[model samples]
Target: MLILAATPIGQAADASRRLAEVLASADVVAAEDTRRLKRLAAELGVEVGGRIVSYFEGNEERRTPELAAMLVEGQTVVLVTDAGMPSVSDPGYRLVVAAIEADVAVTAIPGPSAVLTALAVSGLPVDRFCFEGFLPRKSGERMRALTELVAERRTMVFFESPHRTEVSLRAMAEVLGEDRSAAVCRELTKTYEEVARGGLGELVEWAAGQEQGVRGEVTIVVGGAPSDSRTYAPEDLRELVAARQSDGLSRKDAIEQVAGETGTRRKDVYDAAHS
Candidate 1:
């Protein structure tokens, strides 16, 4: 059997009783960070009687098969990460997949997750939400990813490095609109936990002004665009077309502008204006 366990995100007392019990008696423990695992075990007063093995990003490939073999032998194999749940932007996904393929019983010890923690406190509408783990570090790739999500109607959640928070917010403002509502959660479940809520453009400005810089884990939540209103008047479309036309724009440019501003088809705008 393979047990993917969840560790505390920040507060030690948040560790569940079942997690401690399994850690104490499992036949083998696969940890992302052995040092942190040992500390957690000590804090919980659970003496790990089983062997502990390191299974992080680098060794996950090699360790998955070995761990699956142990599970096939009917030994209880427990997998844990440094924080939050296993396989959540962390190790244990590969092992779980391998265990499933090998016909081994695989389960999870659900516990603390930064994604949910921040989302819950964000004050933004969370009835419908999507988790976008982390944006690509490269500026171009990150912009491309955000462009695809521009029409996402559900509130979006994302994890970001403190150093890049400003840059990410700037890109989000550009793609998702400057006035879009968003929240930035920092150091969640800890004493210094903070949640900053404002427009994406406001956050970009705030981040730029911060000389001290941000620290600890961060989760950003942006509210979805409103879905109720869709009507546009003919007068509004005419005004848009006339403004673009007055800017020395071509007939094609005026029609395109009217279409984009009024959410009407370009052909309809062209036909209406020509007629």
Candidate 2:
């Protein structure tokens, strides 16, 4: 049997009752971070009677079969990450696949997740939303990715590193429009947690003023393009492209993003920009 448990994102009290019981008496426990798992066990005041193993991204592929074998032999396996539920942009997915293929029963001990935590607090409409785990690191790749979402109707959520929060926000502002609404959620569910909401451009300046770089975990939630954006004309797209170009995006990227948002063909926007 395989049980995926969600750990408290930051608040220990958030740990579910089923999670504590499974942690106290599983045959084996696999965690993304062994040290964090130990700390969680200590905080919960539960004795982990089972063997503990490291099952993070680096070794999950190699260790999946070994863990699966244990499950095949009727051992109950508890999978956890440093925070949140297993396989929610975490590394427990491979092990889950292995368990399923080996004819083992798999279940979850659901608990806290930063994704839903951020979404719930964000002022943006949450009725429809999508999670984009992480954007590409390079500026160009990041811009390209944001451009693709310029016209997405559903509110979007993204995970970004503290060091690059400013960069990512700036890219989003340029591609999505400076007036686009967004929220920067930092250190969710923990002490000093914050949710900064405003126009994307305002958030960029806010991120820039962070003297010590945005600290702790970050989740960015940006409201989607307006419904009327799809009816924009070529002249309107040219003006939009010029705005992003003024914001330091390359001319090519500006055209690409403008075209995406306005539903205009790239070549059409290109011709409009030249004219």
Tell me the spans in candidate 1 whose CA falls farther than 4 Å from its real position. Answer: 228-275
| C-alpha RMSD values across all candidates | 5.6, 3.5
User: Model 1: per-residue lDDT, tens digit, 194-233?
Assistant: 8888999998888888778867888999997666356556
**Residue 258: error of model 2 in Å?**
5.4
Task: Give each model's whole-structure lDDT.
Answer: 0.87, 0.90
Worst 10 residues of 2 by lDDT: 228-237
Q: TM-score each candidate.
A: 0.83, 0.87
How does residue 2 of candidate 1 score in lDDT? 92
Clashing residue pairs for model 2: none
Give lDDT tens digits, candidate 2, residues 70-112.
9999999999998898998898888888888888999998789
